[model samples]
Target: MKKTLYSLFVFFFFIAGLTNVRSQDISLPAPEKTGGKPLMQALNERQTTRSFTKDDLTLQQISDLLWAGWGVNRPDLKKRTAPSARDFQEISVYVALPGGLYLYDAFANTLKQIHNRNIGALSGTQAFVATAPVNLIYVADLGKLGKKEGDEIKDAELFWSYANTGFIAQNVYLYCASANLGCVIRGLVPKDKLAPEMGLKSNQVIILSQTIGVPQK
Candidate 1:
């Protein structure tokens, strides 16, 4: 009986250790909603960069970036920084960092811990993706559009979702430009390999991914 108890204790600790390694909710600093380059200059500087350094982003920067991408500006109606068709606001932003994959809750302005693995490498097909500090995977949660469980997701139904994600991605691009960071919006994600890693449901369709980091000088 003592031996059995010892085995159980060890197993419990092992599970706990693994759990600690796999999940962490980062409560980001409040975003600075003001003070950047003029809108025209940000537009002019918006561009893609495929090279990056592995330097992690600061908490403030992460907060601001996520806010720019899709944070809710109007809480009364729950409207986001980016608009959606019929205001469904169905796009879900999954952030893959060195710690793990997180879901950005724009209204709450928090990064909820999802999977604990460093799945940032799976965000894009390009080699540079593995080294980038941040990978934002935009997923269309069709369930938000009244999709029942196990409802089929047709490609035709995703047109509006694609448009919604584009607005969010462009916001990220402009934010990167204004902040003097580097980013690239990409569609070359290995969705098959990534869905499992991200712990996504069948109703969650991967739309696009955008990688960001300190530009390699």
Candidate 2:
């Protein structure tokens, strides 16, 4: 009986360690920069899709999608694929996957784990959000725009942030179109509920969320 108990304890401890390691930051593969449908073809195919299969996006696909969305293109200038107002670069992309929540570090090309718990259902109000394999949350840091943590943020002040998010979202859309993936830019997010879950600071604001996955046939 004593030997059996010791074995059980060791097994549980190993499992716990594995879970912890799984939640650590992920170094994404270098994005594939070349080769996709022609620009005009991707534009022509650009569309919104709501039905997504439960199939998960491969690591390569995730890396490429993020690069297309907002990754750094001109490393020397530290410029990104999507333009930001005054180059503020206030919008940050947070990824909600079945495994956990992660923030995309465009410069490092890494996914910084925010938490291990899956928060897909909390990402949006639609039923598809919960089941989708990937959900991209766009957050704007008002502090970067000169607002203090407690300062009241106005809609006018967020005009540029909204515009920036649009640029990034569109990039993702075109990438999806080219990759034959399904995606939808969503506005029906429960921000009040999600902000805390994301552990966002008072100055960090949720701008939009996009759901992505394989198209359900």
Candidate 3:
């Protein structure tokens, strides 16, 4: 009798978990592409910020931020805002929000929920990462580069991926500057620990992490 009751309990727990994940999936509003501080000005103003406030950003801000980083600029060509070497476009942007972790679906203008668990602290080693409103994890899908999942990924193979991530990260930097937000691109990520939490496959390599939030005043 105890065995049967335990099995039923486990079954209900699994179903509830799936329901929570489905509920956490978010459909973002269309990004605001026009009107901001001009290009040169945003560039000049761009700087790394370590201090951040716990205030949450609006859904609109999140939408625009992801779009600026990697949205499809040319729908006809399916091209992105940031350039990719040989157009491999291997980088996938995963957002770590207070509510959960999500992958930025640039084409759909939506954030597909990865899990309904907050992994903000795992996004970086910095103390501020634990409280930042957003953390963007730049992951490289090596499958697009002809490497099979579970295959060993070499540093040489990731040469172009690093450069590609830089472009995307910089795009976010500029967007933060124009929006008067604070952000810092970080290399001090605990990849070994974070990878498992993010459920990353062998082929999906984390390249960098960027934290974004309102500057603490």
Clashing pairs counted in every model: 1, 0, 0
Off by over 4 Å in 1: 1-23
Give the candidate number with the greatest lDDT. 2
- Sort every candidate by lDDT, greatest first: 2, 3, 1
Instruction: Flag regions of model 3 displaced more than 4 Å.
Output: 1-22
| CA deviation > 4 Å runs, candidate 2 | 1-23
lDDT digits (tens) for residues 1-217 of candidate 2: 9999999999999999998776598889999999999999999999999999879999999999999999999999999999999999999999998889999999999999999899989999999999999999999998888889989988888899999999999999999999999899998999999999999998999999999999987
Candidate 2 lDDT trough over 10 residues, lowest sum: 18-27
Of the candidates numbered 1 and 2, which has the greater TM-score value?
2
Quote each prediction's TM-score. Answer: 0.88, 0.89, 0.89
- What's the lDDT of the predicted structure labeled candidate 2? 0.95
Which residue pairs clash within candidate 3?
A: none
Relative to the unseen true structure, what is the Cα RMSD of model 1?
4.6
